[model samples]
Target chain A: MGAAGIGGGTVNLYSWLSQFFGDPDRRHGPDSIVHRVGEHLLFSGEALGWALLLAVPLGLLLGYTGKAAGLVTALSGAARALPTLGLVTLAVLLAGVGDTAVLVPLVALAAPVLLVAACEGVRSTDPDLRDAARGIGLTHRQVLWQVCIPWALPALLAGLRTAAVQVIATATVASYVGLGGLGSYVVGGLATRDFAQTIGGALLVVLLAVATQLLFALLIRYALPAGLRRARD
Target chain B: MIRFDGAAKRHPDGTLAVEGLDLTVPAGRTTVLVGPSGCGKTTILRMVNRMVEPTAGRVLLDGTDVAQLDAAKLRRGIGYVIQQAGLFPHRRVIDNVATVPYLLGWDRKRARTRASELLELVGLPPETARRYPFQLSGGQQQRVGVARALAADPPLLLMDEPFSAVDPVVRSGLQDELLRLQAELNKTVLFVTHDIEEAVRLGDQIVVLREHGRIAQVADPATLLAAPADEQVAAFLGRDRGLRGLALRPAEGIVLLAANTPLDGWTLAVDQEGRPTGWQRSAETIRQVAVFRPGLDTLRTALDSAVLSPARVAVAVDHAGRVIGLAPRAAVLDALDAAGPDTAAGITATGVADGR
Candidate 1:
């Protein structure tokens, strides 16, 4: 289903670009593809920056304190269940249609993934290790920061990777609110019945997913402890 | 010196973990609290460091009420070791050993340096200090736990069944190490154990607790084994108190051997001066007699000599006498059999003189 969606979206994307270049003559050019790719890149970068800045502290707080956890979980679950279009509309209503519309919902979607991951990670740490820390006379805060946080790093990072990929894939929905991403070409192509533009946009999304996954894999490989890596392996 | 005065611990649900208890752990000596499970031996141990507070009365350390001390600060000043070592898996052995020192605000380098020294003191090589707790075996981990407790050189040490988690062989080794450490350091120690044999072996003073946390009796190991305060204490010490008491008795003063006796198997030959010269075999009996001195043989040695000798008699002799008493195989058997299945009051002080 995902492969076919990407193919259809990519075809529509190419056809929509051909019209903008004023080419009734059926010919392919790199310029249109390049321009769309650049737009996709710019949109992803902004979305990623917002996702990280908002998600990290929220994740840390939810992970460490465990207070107000049920409320945070419920709100995150509700946000996640909402349709992408509904979120964009809500964001547009709240902040007016633009980048903020896209940014707000993207952060909302990513925060919960990160927060839940961080909380579970901290909770799952060995109780024996915690007791040992207390036995050794570490303060509660010292135990949290020095022992629990570092121990939970691998799980927290895995959550961040999930949030990053989800944000990239969902960034296409931002186009419906007129934020102008690779999704713009798909939406415009669908309106004008342009197969190439849709196919091209869908292809860009697939490539973005694969590339982001590989990048995060490399990051996790370098970042996680050998013991955690072996455990997962 | 540590004293428990009317100390009682009542849990939230009204279960009395420890009842009104009065005891003193003498300075520079080991006092072992031993009892069956649920007898509150461990609870009593934790109260000394304020890990478990007494609901009534107070625990005093050197005459100062423990409740008045800052819990963390007080704990830092007292060494506490629990069963299973309770070592931090993430920490290297040295860092674990240095825990108390680190808590007391010693510089990292100095604490670590002291930790390395303690590792050696506990008979672990310096290389072991770099490894994590999980990397070590159970025995090694317990040793590290002990080393960690001693790092701050605290005048008081509390151990809660520290060797109970290890196998018997390892437990014996650890017990010996503890004795050696105590001999050199002379720190006031309160050690808790469920094993009566362990209590007999390690305790200079043994405090036996009955069910519901009441003190059954408190006395030196020999006295406790000899004269249990009641049937409860006697039963806790087990039916083999005599054999156990033999283990506690030193070979020095108890055994008596003949002077100018015929050379025999497993016999210690001594000079007229009553110093040991050599051991003789029964098969190689000689016309000349050899004096065997006291203070050099144990009940086990005397038994071995009686068994291997053709005459079937081992003599007990002092410096002046040719032989004070003859320990025939039947006589040794009679003494052991006479001690059978009963708590013999005053047995510890009766037979053997206190030796240096």
Candidate 2:
């Protein structure tokens, strides 16, 4: 824990570097780094899927109706204050340790970010646009789908990017609830006194977050209306 | 035809936007509702399309009550244009123009074809169809707005200060374009504007409104300027209403003197194209020779030319811009007298000339 620790930590930089690039001895069979990376993605992706399922329609509805806007902001603010560890612990106690315990807090973590983004995206549609759309004979439903949704896509995607990054970072807590994901290394490393494994696992999570951000960045670039893209550039 | 029979709109706050309004907009003609701000001219225009539902009364389109019609369907059958052009920022110009057609469930190819036709009709270049609204200037956006409104070929058009956001030069150009389009298409248009000059220039029948959509006067452009209902309307028409009235009359009736006739000590100079170059008197020359076309130009143009000319005679030209003859200021005045008192009462040839 003295000179062996680099940057005032017990983890050796040389060991951490080798572990990051080389095959790990700890993971056997399906628990390999590649397999764990996939599990981590699946775990975080499920959380995001659940968050989007719950938040998107609700956000679109609130945004289109322009009702309960304050509630969205308040909910997002309160969700931001939630401690992932505490939620995971409570979820485990209430529902028993499983995917549900790991997922509950991560979904809670991601949904509000998405909900606020979706709501704001739709709500920020130019009032003049709504008026013109209706005047030009767009039905209420048509206005919502044709005008509001397309206009909201950029903001919604932006929110998705933010939520995806947060969910990936926080999904490490899955290891706390007896789940298999990239978080296995950190929890298992700490237990076995293998600090290099902890650092390498943490680095993998960082890589995953960056990858998600880049993926969404490309989606936003391609998915935005051509006019919107031109305007931004 | 659209009729507002006792149409009134009272807001939830008990504010009257338009009170007990009774008016009829004739079919296939331009009717402009013009007044100062807060006069409810826009409200009156919106009523025809049911954008503003008359709270106390009904608006009738053709023989049926507009209130009874499905609002979206009714709006689809009537074109609506507003200030800021209100073009969808996300759509290409063609797609924006094709909105109504697309909403009507027309096939994409057909809608786009109609949109392209409309863009050309509104004087936009073919390439403009591929660009977005923001890529164009304010005036071009307005042209696209007009094109979009006309895409479905609706029988009626509602324009709420459609050209007000543009510069004065562009506004004039748009007004000219509207006039040209109106001549060819003859759609029933209800235009709202705060500018009386715009009302006179574009309206077949101008309705001057007071506060709360009260009708101050409704008359053809000439009569409205020549004879307003009261002092308020006269003031609203502005101090130059008489001179403005001349713009509505044709220059057809003026008696022209021979092109070769000599003015006292002054000679008309002509270029190789036979267009008047200047009025020459010995070594001195007045290079500015105001000219007008008798068949195509307005009485105002004729009068303006005569007043602006150094020889006090308007040079008459044909379509080719070659000299046809000349109309002295007196002859122009005589033509004004022949037109009738309704247009000539407050206006005098000297008054117009002196104003310059």
DockQ of each: 0.22, 0.74
Query: What do the candidate models score in CA lDDT, each in turn?
Result: 0.73, 0.87
Error of 2 at B183 (Å): 0.9
Q: lDDT of model 1 at residue A19?
A: 46
Q: Which runs in model 1 stand beyond 4 Å of their true positions?
A: A1-80, A178-233, B254-356
RMSD after Cα superposition, model 2: 4.3
TM for every model, in the order presented, reads 0.75, 0.94
* TM-score of the A chain in model 2: 0.92
By DockQ thresholds, what CAPRI class is model 1? incorrect
- Writing each residue's lDDT as its tens digit, candidate 1 over B1-356 gives 98889999999999999988888788888988899999999889988887788999899999999999877677777777888777765567888898888778899999999999999999998899888776788999999999988999999898989999999999999999999999999998999999999998898888888876787787777777777878878888898786566554433433233444553335656567654444467565333333234455444555655665555675666656445644556665555555444443324432111211
Give the CA lDDT, 0 to 100, for residue B191 in model 1.
Answer: 94
- Model 2 spans with C-alpha error above 4 angstroms: A1-11, A24-28, B344-356
